[model samples]
Target: MADDAVTTGPEHTDEPVRVGLVGAGPWATMTQAPMLTGGPETRLVGVWARRAEAARELAEPYGVPAFTEYGALLDECEAVAFAVPPDVQARMATEAARAGKAVLLDKPIGLTLAEAAGLAEAIDSAGVVSQLMLSNRYRPRIREFLARAARFDTLGAQARQITRAFVAGPFAFGWRLEYGVLHDVAPHSLDLLDAAVGKIDRVHATGDTRRWVALTLEHTNGAVSQLALTGEVPEGGYTELAMFGPAGELRLDFRDLAGDEADSAAGWATVRREFAAAVRSGRPHALDVHRGLHLQRLIDQALAGLR
Candidate 1:
């Protein structure tokens, strides 16, 4: 196979793939930048940001020159990694896909599902390798849970995914609270459960500023899940899921295990690497585009329920 051929490819020539990144945000710095730096198949050559100063700091260590213009960055890279706000993700992704540049977009694809559907359709038409960053699936705890599930499935009647706690990042654009937990963090676990078990038939949710969200999801597999997301808890709490199945039970707490210092984005590094390896082997990504779109729709329904 190609990936087995010397286990190395031309680095950054026409043979090697090039990646240009947009938004020198913390997510990009912590997740994509580090992963790309360590990956052999891709090169990080450019970064675009509104502020050149901030871009230089994050981009330079990765050996990529910073640019102030997003369009110029898109024009050059074979693929683009977007780490901007949810509202801006669609616009950039759609434009880049249309420009024939493959894209790696952050989740909560857009403010709503219709927007997400549009972007999905656009990316499909472009015939490019578009990937969404969904790392919770790669969490060893979660992956083990899935491995053990096998045929019997995880939840018996109903289980719950709980996400609670608060974070205060001064660098954030302050748009964090506007989207609610379902859009912000719930997608990770929700997408996991959806893939591990099945689709969510319905979700009823309610919450406010003090609490990120308090919600429940009912799966078509006859599993019901209660999800609690809030910020009142100290140390910025994290995600935990308990699945009740016929065979037995499975539980994983992403926060308690890692404590406060977990990279939060480390799982994503593996997810991207797996995707790259699959592309080289001509196999489907572990997670597919439809799953991403379906999760977006579930978020859409949950948000509508809130209203």
Candidate 2:
């Protein structure tokens, strides 16, 4: 067996997996809770947050029990959906895995590579179904975009994620503001480029995370991807990913989506469905904890380049 091996194999069952939400922040309240309840393959069993009131408020609408204790929430579910800050996610997710519950995680899984590595070790030891909530990856449109891109002999790519998230909004504060865009926005673009192009072998970066940062990634397939990211834009920000090759350009623009809420709900629904499938089959997903760790490593490399 390889050193990075996760699960033994698929368990193959048909029952719905009981899932619990771990966080009362905007992400859990707005996206996680609603989607988990609406999905047929998984059941939202309970909610846990550091603050009891927050958990109660988020869980009440779904008719699920709210607990202040993490362990109590874990006991009610076979899977955990996390929407907390990276540091908090790293700690709680590790415990969730140790308790033998699968985890649905957010990107840049941890603030630091060490924290991510520790979580990955726990997942490997527990052999639980683990999947990262790389929201775009779960989107049907984005999946189709990737499928089409796969058909081309991709040579190089460009991606940009610009936002005023840090200037104002619910996400303006907290870990996002404290840690900056490297941990906040870079993960999504990095994951997309890695998926659309090929495995990233090296990264050269410049600028600061708080403002604008640029990265030139060298993929193992010899395709290069350039990224420009920032959360301090003046007005409404834009996002686009374009790949260039002899065949022409393949592009994805975030503005083309119907609406943020509708698009996000669609993505979340797919996430719950896939997570449940992985748990039932006992098969590790392509975007599992290990993929999160891989992205973490790439971010670490980018940080190093900045230094």
Candidate 3:
């Protein structure tokens, strides 16, 4: 296809939007990295991993510079995809923001709200584009559910169900469980809930690192949703969201794509693409820095047991 009649979205530019990827993990290697192949708007300019060898392995196939330092990658690229673990998120995000680089951070942006907020503030204060990865929003089914649920009066007296995450087999053997279910899974569900119902008002949660969390949330719109987080049950821990109001019930089965290669990036799904477009227009990203900070604040409260 011609670059002018670009298939991805609007024309990013004739030249690629050079990107530096921080965290050359499996997700980056498979999904996010491959986005470069089909789009004329962007290019994978570099890859950074904690280990230089792993960085080289992931970045080599894409023919980009490989490094063990994120600063090096940032110095040479216009933006970055931050796929690093939570502990290091604030530091890296702050650095990129300080550099005025467009940043795409992975889901559950940070370990705590304070860190996420601080980084978010820096990103915003610097006037840079940034978005957290909540690609589930791009799924067609979820979009449909949001529309149907928007007319709450149309659906009535439906059961609201929330199942805990089930992790077994090799899928169970990872850092996801180590980080616990909420941080790993809530990013997708919480955002969906906020969109479907209104913003969450009060939350009551009960659980621990070893077992499960039963959460009840009151939405600002007088809608309530219960989140049962059972980590790694036999059938596996998947999320099912059902909304019933006056007319019909809207149900969405949200599969956990945390480390899954196929669904990790979820396309030029939502914010990043918006951010990219913003870069072209010389304006702010559609996702904006405030949204990310707000989500981080929510993440923090949950972790802090504020609910």
Which candidate wins on lDDT? Answer: 2
RMSD per candidate (Å) reads 5.1, 3.5, 5.7
Q: Would you list the rank order by TM-score, best first?
A: 2, 1, 3
Q: Model 3, clash count? A: 13
Candidate 1 accuracy as lDDT: 0.66
lDDT per residue (tens digit) for residues 1-307 in model 3? 0001111345455666778888767667755777644466667888888888989998888777797777788889888877677657678978888998877777767777777778877887888767556665654454556776666642212222233343453335345667776777666666666667667666666776436656676776667777666565664445677676655566666553344544434445334455466566656543445655666666566666834
Better of 2 and 3 by TM-score: 2
Over 1-307, each residue of candidate 1 has an lDDT whose tens digit, in order, gives 0011012222233233578878878888877777766756667888887679978998888777898887888877887878888768888888888988777777778777878888888878877666667766655555556665545555533333343323555333345666556677677767766655566778787866336566677877677777666544545455666667666766666656575334445465555565455444433453545556787888877777778
Give all TM-scores, in the order shown: 0.83, 0.93, 0.82
Task: Give lDDT tens digits, candidate 2, residues 1-307.
Answer: 0012123333333677899999999999877888788867788999999898999998888888998788988888999999999999999999999999999999889999999999999999999989988888878788778778777778898999998978988889988988888899988888888878888889999999889999999998899989999999969799999999998988999999848666667777777777887888888988898899999999899899888
Best by TM-score: 2
Candidate 3's C-alpha runs over 4 A off are 1-12, 154-175, 255-272, 286-288
Reference-based TM-score, model 1: 0.83
Score candidate 2 by lDDT: 0.86
Q: How high a TM-score does candidate 3 get?
A: 0.82
User: Which candidate would rank higher by lDDT, 2 or 3?
Assistant: 2
